[model samples]
Target: MIEVKNVSMSFRISQDRIQSIKEYLVALIKGKLKYKDFWALRDVSFSVHPGEVLGIIGHNGAGKSTVLKVISGILKPTSGSVSVHGNIVPMLELGSGFDFDLTGRENIFLNGAILGYSRKFLNEKYDDIVAFSELGEFIEMPIRNYSSGMLMRLAFSIATVVNPEILIVDEILAVGDESFQRKSRQRMMELMSGGTTVLFVSHSLEQIREMCDRVLWLDHGQVKMIGEAQEVCDAYQI
Candidate 1:
């Protein structure tokens, strides 16, 4: 289960670009540092039950990604509270944890460890990850030489290896080739059917209507509406 109650997140952004650390230091010491408080989320409240699929939809800057990051423990809210019970696997910004200088074989362990898997676990699952990525002999090469698709495929392969208790995905389904996209979708469906609670953020209304049980619409940084997928989607369309 996932519960987010009156969660609010804020950041203090510099009003002026200082251009250099020396300039920044000068401004800081001179009490000339201009700043503004940007609230990414404001009094946002929602909950997801075990095995439920909830879709978050909004325009750019509507705080969709910020809220996800908060729930994933990537950011702490300025106020309010978030409670989650389960093993969470976040698929936001695929390959965000990879080292381009590292070979694909080396990065599997590196990225796997970032995802909370131990050395022993990664060692055991190494072959399966390589096979799923279909990188074959290329896995030995530095990932810096890999195409964008190759990089994302390797990251996706390593991330979805475990049956997570809670899955957090952010518009990552369109990975790799068409065949691979279909395969990834099937894998997601398998996880959903296996009773994994999911928090999915996507711009595709069709995907939300088809795959989600409920939808939450965010306007600016607040909850504009939340209801059945079709209902919220239709309301959003209008």
Candidate 2:
């Protein structure tokens, strides 16, 4: 289960765009520095039960992704609280734990380590990870030579191989070709069937309707709606 209660996050952004470090230092010393308070989220609250699938949807700059980051523990909320009751696997970005200089084979271990998997556990699952990625011979090549699609495939494979208790996905499904997207969706289905809690963020309302049991709609950092997937999606679409 996961709960986010009255969570708010704010950042102090420079009001004036300083061109260089020297300019910034001069502004600092001259007491002419200016900042603006930007609130990414405010008083957002929601809950997801174990084995539930919750989809988050919003327009650009609407704080949808920020909510996921807070739940994934990447960003701490400025106020309120978040509680997660299981091991979390967050697929927030491409190549998050990958080393471009390392071969795919090596980065598999590296990525697995970042996910808190033991060496023995990774060794046992290594073949499955490679096979899922379908990099084949390219697995021996440095990741820097791989395309964006290849990086996404590898990242998804590693993140899902161990069946994390809670999976946080943020528009990562939009990567790769149609075929890869289908495969990724099927894998997510399998994980969901196995009782994994899923928190998904996507602009694809159709995908959200198909995959989510519930949906949360955010607008300007506030909870605009939270209810059944179809109801929320239909309302949002209108």
Q: What is the C-alpha RMSD of each candidate to the true structure, in Å?
A: 1.8, 1.9
Tens digit per residue, CA lDDT, model 1, 1-238 = 8999999999888888779999999999999999999999999999998999999999999999999999999999999999999989998978877998999999998999899888988889999999989999999999999999899899999988888899999998878999989887888778777888989999999989999999999988999999999999999999
What is the TM-score (0 to 1) of candidate 1? Answer: 0.93
> Per-residue lDDT for 1-238 in model 2, tens only?
9989999999878878899999999999999899988999999999999999999999999998899889888899999999999999888875677889999999999988888788999999999999999889999999999998898899888888988889888877755689988898888779877888999999999889999999999999999999999999999999
Which residue pairs overlap in candidate 1's backbone?
Answer: none
lDDT value for model 1: 0.92
Give TM per candidate.
0.93, 0.92
Per lDDT, the best of the predicted structures is: 1
TM-score of 2: 0.92
Error of 1 at 112 (Å): 0.5
